[model samples]
Target: AERYKAANQRAVQLLEKCGTTQVEVDASGLLTYPIEKVDAGDQPDKKLKPLSVDEERFMRAFYEANVQEVCSAFEFPHKILATALQYFKRFYLQWLTCVYAACKIEENHVSAEEIGKGIKQDHHVILKYEMAVLQA
Candidate 1:
């Protein structure tokens, strides 16, 4: 343990000497973003918009909870869970379809029928929604 610590210390010292330990300030504007304007989507002028930002967030959170529950029950891999969450946020898709899509994205390749049987859903629905999920 002592030798390991000494080796780590030497490595750190060498990093410092080479200026590799410097903390870089990200000056790229991409690192910064505008704060969300409060109730911006609640304005009356935007008639075509369905849900306001808060409403959408609430719905997304609810759906995400559902997805998490399903994923946990099925013991899915982390990548599938993450991708499902991304699909939830970006596409506002159904939790079942999101998981199905995430499985495809991660190359896990779970069949629609298997997922449907596991979840008590009709297999055809999964197949039907797969195209829509990928298109979005």
Candidate 2:
């Protein structure tokens, strides 16, 4: 319908105004945050863990793909998918838990215990190795 087309066009304009477009690396091989506004996570004394620049980049890139894959399998929206990816990144920012924790939170209604049980991986070992993986 014409109305639907008009509304969709308006939505695209609004998204451009709000800078909700996809983040992309530039042609020069530089990672760029294209959004108009960035809220820095700059709270001193928050006891927040630090991630190295490389680690942060890797985490974002890796989780972005992982989130997309999981969302496709689970039929989730970008919002939920993005939230899970953020949670995974934040959890890694502090202490390392099992990759299962990230997958659980991102995928919904699953737990590290359940994943470990189903996959036959030691939950304890996975948790233990988490920090080292992040460090490496």
Candidate 3:
């Protein structure tokens, strides 16, 4: 509940000063679908058991740690950090490419070299994965 509230505040903040018609962060559509019909998410086998609450919490915490670490290294603003975290959690779950991909998604992309330096990783791997994603 608290996390949702925080996320809502951040979303509202992000929508500010943007020259769009959207005035508020409306999330009514997110709950319109029944869980049985949609919440399985990418799973082809609906018969597969769903994650327990503990498992879900653990997975979210694990990924969030990585998000924090990378965003901290980059010294990103609150918006970018939150946006990166959102992308990782909801869309692109690939930890290896989340940072660079998140930057690109937010329209504030940094150079691959800068991302490599920031994360202390070899730029070649970044290039390799980026190309793979682009090709796919």
CA RMSD of all predictions: 17.1, 16.4, 13.2
2 versus 3: better TM-score goes to:
3
Judged by lDDT against the true structure, how good is candidate 1?
A: 0.68
lDDT of 3 by residue, 1-136 (tens): 6776566556445434221231211122121222333322343453244344456668888988888887787776677778767666764345546667667767776877887787677765555444333333
Model 3 scores worst on lDDT over the 10 consecutive residues at: 22-31
Task: Please give, for residues 28-123, the per-residue lDDT of candidate 2 as tens digits.
Answer: 434466654422233334322334455556767775675566555546556666665665555543122324344544555555465456546555
The deviation in Å at residue 116 for candidate 3 is: 3.3
Give one digit per residue, the lDDT tens place, for model 1 in 10-73.
Answer: 7546543442221211223122224433232344463233344456557877989988988888
lDDT of 2 at 81: 62
Lowest summed lDDT across 10 adjacent residues in model 2 is found at: 38-47
Clashing residue pairs, candidate 1?
A: none
Show model 2 residue runs off by greater than 4 Å.
1-52, 93-136
By lDDT, who's the top model here?
A: 1
